[model samples]
Target: MSIEQRVTEEMKVAMRAKDKVRLIALKGIRAAFIEALKEDGSESLADDRATTILRRLAKQRRESIEAYEQGSRADLAALERAELEVIDAFLPSLADEETTRAWVEEAIASTGASSPGDMGRVMGALMSAHRGDLDGKLANRLVRELLGS
Candidate 1:
């Protein structure tokens, strides 16, 4: 089944199981998917689009968690972490450090990126190659390390 279909099914399962956190996250995902479909005039989102949406949701949750922690709101931080866990259930397998490093090397080679000056080109290639499988911030860090900048 497609990612969209799987998410819909998961939403129903969450409802049946009375999983409040999962249900809320699923609803948010469904709403985002619907909004994207409406905006693009498409019946279903492509896999890449779905992955992108999930990643964006996860990123937002992480940011919220960080902010909550900074504000000394543990309860809100916990909630954001729960939501992040639910959203992460649909994401592609995250790349490990070794894999990320390998991809960074490949990106550098493929883009002929020799110095920090080519960081943008290298980052663009890496993001395109590893989207949904790697976190953008982590990827950027790895690229920077590889470029020694």
Candidate 2:
């Protein structure tokens, strides 16, 4: 099933189970998707785009958790962490370090990126290959390391 459909099913289950955290997280996902659809003027989101929205939500929650922790707000950080877990439940798992390194190598070879100067080309190729499933930050770091940057 599509992410939205799966999310809707999960929402129903959460409501039936009286799981407040799960319910809230699902609602947040719906809201983000709606906002994206409105902004893009799309009839419905593609699978990859929906995944992108989920990743964005997850990223925001992670950043919020960090900020809350730094501000000594444990309660807020816990809430953000809970939401993040729920969000991550919908995202594709990131490739492990080994697999990521392989992609880095493939990206470098395909793009003929032998130096940091070609980081953009390598990144563009990798991002295109993996789309929403790719972790750009990690990929960039790996590519830089491989390129002796």
Candidate 3:
């Protein structure tokens, strides 16, 4: 089944189990999917689009967690952490730093990015090839390290 369908089914399960954090995260996901459908004027969301939405949601939660922690709000950070866990369940596992480093090296070689000035080209290549799999910050750092050497 598609990610969207799986999410809907899981939402029902969460409701039945009275999982507050999962239910809240799923509700937010469903709402986001509904908004995307409305915007696209489609009956359902494509899995790729749904994945993109999930990634965005996950990123927001991570940022919130960081902010809450920085402000010395452990309770809020914990809540965001719980929400992030729920969101992560639906996302594909991200590439590790080593894998991303390999990809960065390949991107540099393929793009002929010999210096830091060509970082944009290398980054664009990496994003197009591995948009959802790689961590942007990690890939960027790898790119800089490879190109700067």
For residues 1-149, could you state the per-residue lDDT of candidate 3 as single tens digits? Answer: 99999999999999999999889989999999999999999998998899999999999999999999999999999999998898899999999999999899888889988888999999999999999899999998888888874
Order candidates by lDDT, high to low.
3, 1, 2
Number of clashes recorded per candidate: 0, 0, 0
List RMSD in Å for every model shown: 1.5, 1.4, 1.1
Top TM-score prediction, candidate number? 3
User: How many clashing residue pairs, candidate 2?
Assistant: 0
Q: Name the weakest run of 10 consecutive residues (lDDT summed) in model 2.
A: 130-139
Residue 133 miss distance in model 2 (angstroms):
2.7
Instruction: Give model 3's TM-score versus the native structure.
Output: 0.96
Q: Please, what are the lDDT tens digits per residue for candidate 1 over residues 44-125?
A: 8998899889888988999999999999999999988988988888888888998888999999999999888899999999
Q: Which prediction has more favorable lDDT, 2 or 3?
A: 3
Clashing pairs in model 2, backbone N/Cα/C closer than 3 A = none
- Best to worst by TM-score, what's the order? 3, 2, 1
